[model samples]
Structures are given as C-alpha cells and as structure tokens.
Target chain A: MTERKLIVSRRKLLRVGALGAGGLMLSGCDSLNRSEGFRSLLEGAEDLHKGFQRLGGEGALAREFAPSDMSPVFRANGNREIADSAYRQMLAGGFADWALKVDGLVEKPLVLPLAALQSLPQRQQITRHDCVEGWSAIGKWQGPQLSRILDMAGLKPQARYIVFHCADRFGSTPYYESIDLIDAFHPQTILAWRMNDALLPERHGAPIRLRVERQLGYKHAKFVMRIEARDSLAGLHGGKGGYWEDSGDYAWHAGI
Target chain B: MSEAVTSDHFKGGDFVRRHRLSTRIWHWINAVAVLVMLMSGLMIFNAHPRLYWGEYGANSDPAWFEIGSNADGQGLVKIGDATIETTGVLGVWTDSEGVVKKRAFPGWATIPSNYSLADARLWHLAFAWVLGLGVVTYLFWSLLNGHLWRDIRMSRAELHPKHVWHDISEHARLRFPTGAAALKYNILQKLAYSGVLLVLLPVVVVTGLAMSPGMDAWMPWITQVFGGRQSARSVHFLCAFGLVAFFLVHIAMVVLAGPINEVRSMITGNYRLPKDREEG
Candidate 1:
C-alpha cells in the first residue's frame, strides 16, 4: 500500500509540475499579446504617427521657383529619340514647323507651334533640380506654366491628368509621362523652352522639356511633341503614366 | 484496466510541439527582412560615416584609422621583381629625380563605398514596404489568435523578486536548466521580444517616414516630435541599433537553448521532450 501511494504521489507531482509550467508559458504569451504595457506602447507609436499626419495636413504645397535658377548645364540622363525616320527628318529641320497638338479631353484642342508657345506669357524660374541619382543642380528655366497653357486650352471637366507624349523612345515603345491635377497647375510646373539663357540644346530636349520642380529627375519629362489631357491613366502604357514607371518600378508619384 | 487505458490516453505528448507555425514563419520572415535592412542601412551610413548625436559633427577634425598593415611596424608591398616597404597614400613612389620616397602610413579608410546613395534609397524604401507589411500582418494575426498573450504573459509568482533573482543568477552563470520548463522561454526573452516588437520597430518606421519630404505634408508632427529632419534621422538610426541588439541576444538565446531542437521546432512545429528517466 505504501509503495502504491508513493507511485501515485510521484505521478501527481509530475502532473502538477507540467500544469504549472504550461500555465507560466501561456501567461508569458498573454503578456506579450494583450498586456497593458505593450498595448500602451503600440498606442503611443500610432498616436505619434497620427499626430504628425495631423500637423503636416493634407495638400501642403511644395516651394515654387523663379526662372533665374535653372542650371546652365542641364544634362539629359536617358534615351533621346523616337526611332522613326520621319521624326528624325523633322528634328533635322529644327522642328520649327512641328506643331504641339494639345488635345484629348480639352474643349479648344489647340495645335500651337513652338514659336507660338514662346510668345505666350512666359515664366522663368531658377530652381534646384534634385535627381533620384543623388545629384542636385540649380538652373534657370524659361517657359510657360502648364496651368496657364491648360487654362488657354480649356480642359474639359472630365480631364484629371495631364499626359506628356515625347519624341523619345525605348525599343518599340514611345516615351510618355503624366501627372495629376495638383502638380498640373503647380506654379513650378512648366514646359521649359530654354536652359540658362540659351535655347535648349538637342541633348537637353532641344526646343522643349518639362520642369516639374517639386519631383525627382525622372518626373522631369523631355522631348515634348504633344500634351494630352486625360481623365484616367488606366489605358496608358503599364498604366503607371511614365517611361520609368513602365520599365522600372518607379513610383507613379515621385513627389520626393 | 480502465485506469491503465486512461493514463495511456493522457500521455499523448503531442501538445508540447516546439513553436507554432505562425511563430516560426514570423521569426524567419523578420530575420530575412532585418538582415536586408541592416546591410542596406550600413551602405547608406557611408554617406556620413561619422555618427553624432544632437547637432554637433564629429569634433571637426575626426580621428581616423586605416587597415591592412601587420603589427611588425614594417610596411610591405610587392613590386614587379622585389618587395618594397612603404607607408601613406604616396606609397613607394619614384620622384621626378628618380628618387624613391616612402611616407608614413596610408590614407585613412572611409566607410565602404560600394553603393550609390540613390540606389540605396530606392532599395531601402521598397524593402521597407515589405517589412512594414510583414510586421503589420504578424501583429494582426497574432492578436486575433491570442498567441501574443499566451506566450508573453507572466504570473505574480514569476514576477517575484526571488524568481527574478534566480533567473538573473542562472543567466549570469550560464546555467540553463534543461527540461520542459527550460523549453519555454524565461521572463527576459518575453520582455525583450515584446519591447522590440511593440516599441523599436514602430519607432524606426515612424522616424523613417517622418524624414521623407513627400510625407511632410501629411505628417509634420513627426518632425516636431523628433525635433527636426536630422534629429528624426538620428532616432531612426538609434532604433535600428536597438533592433540589432535584440537580434544578437535572440541569436544567442537560440544557440544556448539547444539550437537543433529549437530550430527544428520552428521549422517543423514539433519538439520531442527530453525523456524523463525518473518516470521510466
């Protein structure tokens, strides 16, 4: 009877020990998961994030620029041509006759020549061009703000995005870019005609290029031939609205 | 006979399986994400190699060092046909008069100049999204399933001064108790893991996002909280340091706590308990 009692006690002790260990394990897990301390920590972090967001506020404007700061040496960083022979011939003649057709979701659908664009109320801005490739250059750019041009063209109410179709090409694909309405009307957003004081060189988009100052270098579209107003970017190449956007996984909103 | 059957049924021994599948998945995922983040982060640090807290630079004229020389105080280099001893950036250079000149010590080594800043930014930002998503998902799933509470909660007894001292003394002596009790993590593990998950990771993410120019419009308060852009950057680096410390401790724990058994449990969700010779 004593032997049997001893065996029973040992079994009971083992079982009790296991239960105690298991309970501790479960408690430790609970502390990690639902403890007041951890919850407060998480809440504090989230509160900080929300508070920052609140302080910054939505639709805050980036700095605008004057024309004197455009870089004297503005170098093109990517491909420079539309592989078609006809386009090359047009380019050789200085593209004077080349008309920039502004259409699609615009009431006026105006086709303005480069000279006509030059004659328009011009804006010159000397601003810093920050590249995603980690370089910055201050340069003066001469052109009309896209907002004024769009206003003249009279964008339809349905128009939400301004797409820049360029003369450059990558393989069989023609280079194209687009920006939303916020950037579209931004004071710094201009279709630049001249770099520094001279007319833009062929390497620097020749007659015209874009200077979306608030964004990184890739957003600065070059070799402009047409400006199309669209309601959505869905039908565009890769549906992301820029050359690098399609080729590289570049964010559609390269705001920084 | 009925008692024997009942005891047999109770001894199934399956519930003590190592780590749950979810825990294992989260652990390994965090491991990979943290490693990639650290490597890329180190590359980015090369931009300003010296670290400083607050606004001061590294005391203007920073003390610097170079690597690759032996302790014999003799410089050594192999020429076309013979070995030459030289020091400094000029090394063993023949002057315009055909006289060989040796300077003392080579140029100071800078941080590793392997990556471009822009490329590093892109990689960091892109991978950041992955890490953020993983963390969020882990938190949500763990919360929903009650895993967090189950693993990290402590009892009043465990919180006692005696128990805490016992743990500390055992740790100091490197005396890890082996048994089912030891199979479960001690209090320190729970605290460190919780602190990292609930505190450090979120702080790093917030500071990083706060430093972005685009997010400035939406989250200016983050800048205010951290003092400024540079301050936020400093905090981000500090939080990253905390995470690295946690990672080192965690690895050490894994090594000490029967690496194979622990690793297999994480991978396969099963662990065989050490056989109890007393019962046998």
Candidate 2:
C-alpha cells in the first residue's frame, strides 16, 4: 500500500512538474518579451555578434560562386514594383532621364544618369544573396564598385555612413538603408544595373539596386534614387538604418 | 516504484559523490539555455519552414524537407517524396488566443509564442552565446580536472561488443548498478554523454556559424565544408532534433531510474546507492 501510494504521487508530481513548468515558462517568456528592459537586454547580443564579425578584417570578402551555380529562378523579395507615380513614370520612360543623386557631406554633389553609370568601369561577379527570411539565391551582378562612385563625389572626412534613399515605400514611409564606410568601400559593394546577363527587371529592382554582398538581402536597398553620405544614422526614418530594421525590429547590421 | 527508492525514503547503502560541482553547474545552465535555443530556433524556422541543399535555394527551388499547408488548410510535412499529415501540431495550429495560426510549429513550443521572427531571432541569438560559452567552459574545466578521462572515457574492454551488449541487456532489464558500482557510469552513459559533449555540441555550433553570412566572409570554407549555407542550415536543424531525441530518452531514463533520486543527484551532486540483494 505504501509503495503504490508513493508511486502514484510521484507520477502525479512528474506530470505536474512537466506541464506546469512548461506552461509557466512559455507564458512567462511572452510576458518578459513585452518588457522593454528585457527586450533591450536580449538585443545587447547584437553588439557582441557585430564585434566578433568585425574581427574578420574589413577587406575580407564574402564567398563568391561560379556562374554555373546561379539559381534558375531567383526570387524577387520586397517591393517588387514601386506604386509611386514618379517611380512608375521613370520605369515607363525606360529610366533614360533617371539620375542617381550623389550629395550630402561631399565636396562635389553630382547627378549621374543611367548612361553615365553604365559608362563607368564595370565589374561582374556571381555571388550568393542570403535573405533574413532563410533563403539564398546566386546570380551574376554587373555594375561599378560603389567605391568608384564615392571617389567621384569626394566624401568629406566627417562622413561616416552612406545612406541609400530608395523609390519604394511601405504605405507612407519611404524605404532606405545605411552602411558604414568600411562596407561602403567594400570591393563587392556595387550599384548593380544588370543581373544574370540581362537588364535588371522592375520586379527585381530594375535600373539599379545597392548590393552589399556581405549582408542579408534587406540591406540591399532596391530602386535606389539617392546616395547620401551621413555622419550618423540618427534623425533618419525611424532612426534605424534600413526599412526592415526600422519597422520590423530587424538588426541594422544584418551580416548575420 | 518502490517506496525506498523515493528521495525522502533514502534507506540506501551509502551516499556517494556522483557528480562534480562543475558538472552540476554546467548541466543546470544548459538545461535552460538549450531549451530556450531550441524553442526560439523553431520559431525562426517557422519563417521559412523549408530545408534545401547547395549554396543557393529560394521559393521556386525544390526543397528536400518542408512543413506546409495545402489549399484545403490541411497541414502536411514533406520529406523527400514522403508526406505526413501533422495537423494541429505543425504547419497549422490554433494560438492561445483561440485564433487559427498557419505556422510550421505550434505557439506553445516557441519562444514569445507569437509570429515574430525578429523576437525569435533575439531570443535565439542571446541564448546562443550562453550555450556556446557553456560548452567551451565545461570542456576546458573537464580537461583540466581530468573529469573527461576519469569519468567519461571508456576502457578498451568496455568498447568491445560483448561488454557493450551486456551493459545494454542490463539496462534493458532495468538492472541498475548498486552499492559501489553505482558510483561510476556504465559504457552506455559514457557514450551518450561523450557524444553530446564532443560530437553533437560542436557540430551544432560549427553548422550554426556556417549559416552566418558575416562568418562566411571570415571563414568562407565553413559553408563549403557542408556543401553550402543551406546544407549547413539543414545539418543544424537535424542536429537540433538529434539533441531533442537525446533529451527525451534522458528524461525517460531519469524517470525510470527514480526521478527524485536521479534529479537530486544532478542538483546536489550526491547519489544514494540502491542496496544490493542476493538472488535466491
């Protein structure tokens, strides 16, 4: 009788412990997630990841793939087509009049048209684009290195970050992204005008898109209309560096 | 199930030191950290509930494994050519608020319990450091203190099939070691523990680093080792489920071996041996 009673109670205790602890923990985590302090504490890990990533050296390049490795169907994600009339007009006009505005914290502010951008020394590389949504696609991208454009404009010493103002928008908010000077000067960083040997399609950020090869897809702002050199990311939209970072709580440094 | 097996009714042969302080500390910390990482990782998986191979794969690409819902709202898990219906558990389930959710994993099994990939990543990344650092620290300490060789290493004789089969049969019959014999781990325990410490933990960490694009820049060959980033992701997922399988068996063994006593031994580092009896 004593043994049976002990067995029954132990079984009950185990059951209760498993169910109760699991339930309490799940609900407790949800509540803790809502707390600003707790969320910030968790976000603190971003700094550690960033610091460790920088230890790889600034000039280190992301692995590039062969042309044969390119995906047959490279999926276009986010803002496939800008609904704004100004952007639609430019698209309809074949982006002939479209000019990339280069200004802010620069000695010379210049507007380069599509032809001028194409005329610059071009580079083509096949690279894998990793998305934050857990997908990757390889494609050949052709464009001049971003460093060449920055050199053409002559960046000021105070300029610490390069911000890309895009034509796409989510509701009333315009899409934008920023990168540090190290990434800005990266050899692979380019304003890709062509993909997979064809003129860039509208669904895939036609005419031009910022391709920061080392980072996730969201950091590669599409429909890039203006490139501004800024000393800081603050005072920008939502005070975050990119659209997803601002609205979706994505980390501004999306190298991970 | 015997009354004497209860922690409170400890009429055992002797109370012996079964686990060291370092082992106990590492075990408890990992108990929380590993679960957090797994749950949050499931939430992250919910974002794209598909696994593939090679350096590149997206929506249009063929996936080797995927948890998805058809047009009829039936939840299905597909692995290669085989498909399993997993309604109400995965692919499709109702949340705590009584609303239907179309996610890969149930809310109860995920951190934050809602569809927030950002929040899930936060939880996953934060606990990753804890789990990663804990493995490193525990391994270093075990090496320094000779716990790795003294407690976990199996002798050449123990590695023999006959000795292993004997231990397995003993475990199958629930014939647990008694008296002084209970102080040391059998061959099975050593294998499981060593597998977790050396193989599973290290592979999981390395595969995780392989998925990071920034880390890819630092060590491009990491991804290449697994064929590609997506392959690394698949390996990471498999290893996580492998750990889960180990956890389930470990818990069942704890219950069968006397939960109160086993848990107390883990927590307090002291275990009371079962009294040995002569068979008639």
Candidate 3:
C-alpha cells in the first residue's frame, strides 16, 4: 500500500513540477519582452552597430564589381513614376532645361545644369543595391562625386545633415532623404545621372539621383531637385530625415 | 559520451549531476534570445515574401520559394517543384486587428504583433546581440572551464559507424539512460549540442553579417562568401529554420526523457534518475 501511495504522489509531483517550470519559463520571457529595460538594451545594440559601422569611415569603400557582373535586370523600387506635374514636364523635355539647385546653408548658392553636371569629373561604379526588403541588384552608376559638388557649393559652418529634396512625391509631400556629413563626404556618395553605361531611365530616377553606397536603397533619393544642409533634421518632412521614415517608420541610418 | 555504450541502465532512486550551473544559465538565456529572434525574423521575412537562388532576385525573376495568397483568399506556399496550400496558418490569416489579410506570416507569431517591419527589426537586432554575445561568452567559458573537453567532444571510438548507429537505434526506441549512465550525455545529445553551438550558430551569425552592407564595405568578401546579398539572405533564412528544427527536437527529447527530471536538472543542477524499468 505504501509503495502504491508513493508512486501516486510521485506522479502528482511530476505533473505539478512540469507545469510550474514551464509556466515560469514562458512568463519569464514574456516579462522581459514587455519591459522598458529590455527595449533600452535593444536600442543600445543598435547604437553599437552604428558606432561599429562608422569606425570604417572614409577609408571604407563598398565592393565594386566588374561591369559584366551587373544584374541583367535591376529592380526599380518605390515610386517608379512620380505624380508631380513638374516632374512630368521635366521628363517630357528630356531634362534639358532642368537645373539641380544647390542652395540653403551654403556660401555659394549655385544652380547646376544637367550638361554642367555631365562636364564634371565622373566616377562610375558597378555596385550592389541592397534593399531593406531582402532583395538586391547590381548596376553600374556613373556620376560626379557628391563631395565635389558640395565643395563647389561651399557648405556653411552650421551645416550638418545634407537633405536631398526630390521632385517625386508620395502623396501631398515630395519624396526626400537626408544623410549626415560622414556619408555626404564619402567618395562613393554621388548624384548619379547614368546607369548601366547609359542615361538614367525614368523608372530608375532619371536626370539625377543620390547614391550613398553604404546605406540601404531608400537613402539613395531619386529625382533630386535641391540640396539643402541643416544643423538638425527636426523640421524635415517626417522629422525623422526621410519620407519613408515619416510614414513607414524606417530607420534614417540604414547602414545595416 | 560514446556511442559504444556497453550497456543500458534505466533505473530509479538515483541522483546525478546532469548540467553544470553555467550550462543551465546559458541554455535558458539562449532560449529567450532564440525565441525572440525567430519570431522577429519571421516578421522580417514577410517584408520580401519571396526567395530565389543565385546573385539577384526580385519580382521579375522566378523564385524558387514563395508564400502568398491565391485569388480565392487562400494561403499557399510554393517551393521549387511543388506548391502547397496552407491557409489560416501561413500566407493568409487574421491579424491582431481581427482583419483577414494575405501576408506571408500572421501577426500572432511576429514581434510587435503588427505589420511594422521597423519594430520587428529592432526586436531581431536586439536579441541578435544578446544571442551572439551570450554564445561567444558561453563557448569561451566552457572551453576554459574544461566543460567542452570533459563532456562535449566525442571519442574516436564513438565516431565509428556501428557505435553511432547503436545510439541512433536506442534514441529511436525512446530508450534513455538512467542511474549512473544518466550522469553523462548520450552520443546523440552530444552531437546535437555540439552541432548547434559549434556549427549552426556561427553559420547563422556570419551569414547575417554578410548581408549587412556595412560589413561588405569593410570586407567585400563577406557577402561574396555566399555569392551575394540575396543569397546570404536565403542562407540566413534556411539556417534560422535549422535552428528552429533543433529547438523542436531538443524540446521533444526533454519531454520524452521525462520533463520532470529534465526541467529539474536544468533549473537546479541535480537530476533524479528514473528507474531502469521505466517504460520506453
């Protein structure tokens, strides 16, 4: 009788113990999941990633591939055609009369014509375009270094975030993006006017587009109309530095 | 533990030290990190909803793997050479908002429990750091503390085909070691643990690093190692799935071997062995 009673009690013990331990295991994870301390820890990880990436600096260069290695067809993402009337008219005229205005917080507020941009020293690179949505394509981009243009414009002392105002609009607001001086001054950052050894197509941001090579594709603003430098992005369209940032909650620093 | 186990001793009323305190701590820590990573990762995968082979993959190109809804609002998963319908579960389901949509993974299984890829990334990245750092630390600690040398590495004799096959058969038969034999890890447990710690985790981390453009700039070969960024992404997904499989098997082993003893050993570092006469 004692042996049978012992077996019965042990069975109960096993059941209770398993249930209790399993419940604790799950609830522990759940509690941590909901905590602010956990969130901060996650943010700390992001900052660490940013800091580690910035360590490479100007010395770092994105991998450039042979022209033959370019994807047979590059995917055009987000706003292939803009609804802006001005963009339509500019597209119709083949961007002949279009001028990329370089103003705002600059010593020399100059307007650069498409022909003038072509005349500048050009850098052609066949590099991979990584989108945040897990797709990638390689295309040869030819454009003058953005640093060269920024140098020509002569950035003011207060200049910090370099904002690219594009002609395309998602809805009521115009498509735009921004980068810090680190990316703006990088050799790979360019206002590309040509792709795959030919003039850039409307589907892939014709006339001119920003190419901050180290970042995800969203930072490569298309249909660039104006370049503005500001101390902070507080007053920008989304106050988060990009259109996707305002609407989609995308990270402004897409170095990852 | 070697596969050439000379005997099977499953008995009760014996207590043995199964897991070291450090192992238990690391195991549970990883449990949280891995679960968070997998859930958030599913959310990240939803952003693309397609997978392809080779260097570049997009909507225009043919995908080897895809998950989406059909015209009739039914979910479907398409793999190379096969297409299977799985609605109310995978591709199409009701989200947290109680509205039915045809997204790749439902909100119930994702971090943030919504359609926010940005927030999902935050969860994934945060846990990634935890899992990565914890793993590195545990590995180094185990090595220095002689845990790896004393326990994990299999003997040359165990690597023999016949010995290994015997262990496989025993596991298949749901036969577990008890009493004195329970003090050590079986061949299968050793192999599974070592594979996860030494092989799978490192592959997952490196492939993830390869997908980062920042890492590519520092060392272009990082992405090139797997052919390209898209390939790296595919490999990352596969590896995460591998880890999930490992988790499922690990849980099943714990339950099958007796959840009471397994859970207690992990929590308290003392395992009370079941009787050898215990049924399979």
Candidate with best lDDT: 2
* Best candidate (score: TM-score): 2
Query: Candidate 2: misplaced stretches above 4 Å?
Result: A1-20, B1-12, B277-280
Candidate 1 lDDT at A248 equals: 60
TM-score result, candidate 3: 0.90
Tens-place lDDT per residue, model 3, A1-256, is: 9967965776688788668866654455445556888766665666677787878744699989887777888999987987678778888998988999998889999899999999999999989898898888889999999999999999999999899998877778888999999889999999999999889998889889999898889999998989998889997776988998888767778878
i-RMSD of model 1 (Å, 1 decimal): 12.3
Q: Evaluate residue B164 in candidate 3 and report its C-alpha lDDT on the 0 to 100 scale.
A: 85
Model 1 ranges with Cα > 4 A deviation = A1-149, A156-178, A186-252, B1-15, B44-123, B154-166, B273-280
Error of 3 at A98 (Å): 1.5
Q: What tens digits encode model 2's per-residue C-alpha lDDT throughout A127-188?
A: 89999889999999999899999999999999999999988888998999999999999999
Q: Report, for candidate 3, the interface RMSD.
A: 3.0
Q: Which interface RMSD values do the candidates have, in the order shown?
A: 12.3, 1.9, 3.0
Model 2's chain B yields a TM-score of: 0.92
C-alpha lDDT of all candidate models, in order? 0.63, 0.88, 0.83
The TM-score of predicted model 1 comes to: 0.51
Ranking by lDDT: 2, 3, 1
Compute fnat per model: 0.14, 0.80, 0.66
Off-target runs (Cα >4 Å) in candidate 3 are: A1-41, B1-12, B96-98, B278-280
**Candidate 2 per-residue C-alpha lDDT over B1-280 given as tens digits, one digit per residue, 9 for 90 to 100:** 1223324434346666677788899998998998998999999999999999988889899999999998888889999999999989989888888887889999999997988999999898888999999999999998998888777899999999999999999999988777656666789999999989998888888898898889998898898999999999999999999899899989988988878778767767667677765521
C-alpha RMSD for every candidate = 14.9, 4.4, 4.0
Q: What's the distance in Å from true for residue B279, model 2?
A: 10
- Total clashes for model 2: 0
